[model samples]
Target: MRTLRRRMGLLVVPVLGLGLVGCCGSGERGSDASAAAAGFERAISTGDTAAVCAALAPESLSEVEESGKAECADAIPESRLPVGGSVRTVDVYGRQARVVLASDTLFLSQFTDGWKVVAAGCRLRAGHPYQCAVKGG
Candidate 1:
């Protein structure tokens, strides 16, 4: 019985070491995602369009630019100018992520840098574009 226990311990130790290595590698990726999300949030809070654009995926940035809006910074809504509240949560997967923010409204997306207010018209969605559904009537 003692010999059997020693064998099991040896097997378990190697397996646990491998698992730790795997976790460390994955953890690095997660940290990158978190950093990206934080950068995006800071840019939005400051209403710095250039910074925001820098944080966005290239394709999304081009789309906004092609719209012929003034400047990327100018496109931000007045209400969002003085950003308030905290980031409720951030969930990242690969190149995409969702950051739930605390505000009068809910912002959502599958942003490469994390969930962002690419569109502020409506609630959050995984794949669809943002739809501003604020009730103005």
Candidate 2:
């Protein structure tokens, strides 16, 4: 689809900083990372706050709770992070990944449990790490 191609283009452009470069891992790991991102988006779209919180990396969940001054389940939806879009690309490194979607970019980490989103609803800011609406970054 044209939309999918465009979104993939967005991933390649330097402005987004999510190009699939320097990847050095198995495709299976990349698939897992993408699946994790997809699940996170699905949770957000469904308003399953508990599921959303569960998909977040521990530190990110803690930050979300602290920012909201509420429990993670209560805070995740209140954060209003962008979610629910087709995955355009997934770049995986050692225990880390960047999942690019039509609406947002998510940074994830592989934990003992699985891949977890460490940052979501992210935007590149030239000289800094992607600034995220919900971040432990």
Candidate 3:
């Protein structure tokens, strides 16, 4: 339990440098990114490990597995990620996107398959990269 809690803290404080700045509703890109982010959020909130793992980018999934020293299914449930509300904003730049919900922020990237989450449960810190609870190394 103590180790799990410590890992969660590490997740929250890790810096992710994605220099994205813009508003939501940029057309089809925004919609797709928002949809992917919403699906990830929903999966996490509902404790659907399969869906959650599927929604994650490969690197993000690997990071979670490595950090927790467990499989994605067991590790994700222990991360204690925030449950997001309705999509409030979505900013897409090229293939990268950020989706801001009522209570959470997520970063995603477009892949051949579709948009997959790169980071989740992120909080902004002035003059720094986002601090995320789930992200790639």
Provide the TM-score for each candidate, comma-separated. 0.48, 0.81, 0.82
lDDT of 3: 0.78
Alpha-carbon local distance difference test for all models: 0.41, 0.76, 0.78
* Location of the lowest summed lDDT over 10 successive residues in candidate 1: 1-10
lDDT of 1 at 134: 18
Clashing pairs in 2: none
Compared to the true structure, candidate 1 yields what TM-score?
0.48
What residue runs in model 2 are displaced by over 4 Å at the alpha carbon? 1-20, 24-26, 126-128
Task: Give the candidate number with the greatest TM-score.
Answer: 3
The alpha-carbon deviation from the true structure for residue 90 of candidate 3, after best TM-score superposition, in angstroms, is 0.4
lDDT of 1 by residue, 1-137 (tens): 01101131121112222223223313555455445556665776776777866654544445455553654555444324334245554443433333445642222234444544332223433443333321111
Clash number by candidate, in order: 5, 0, 0
lDDT of 2 at 72: 95
What is the Cα root-mean-square deviation between model 3 and the actual structure? 6.9
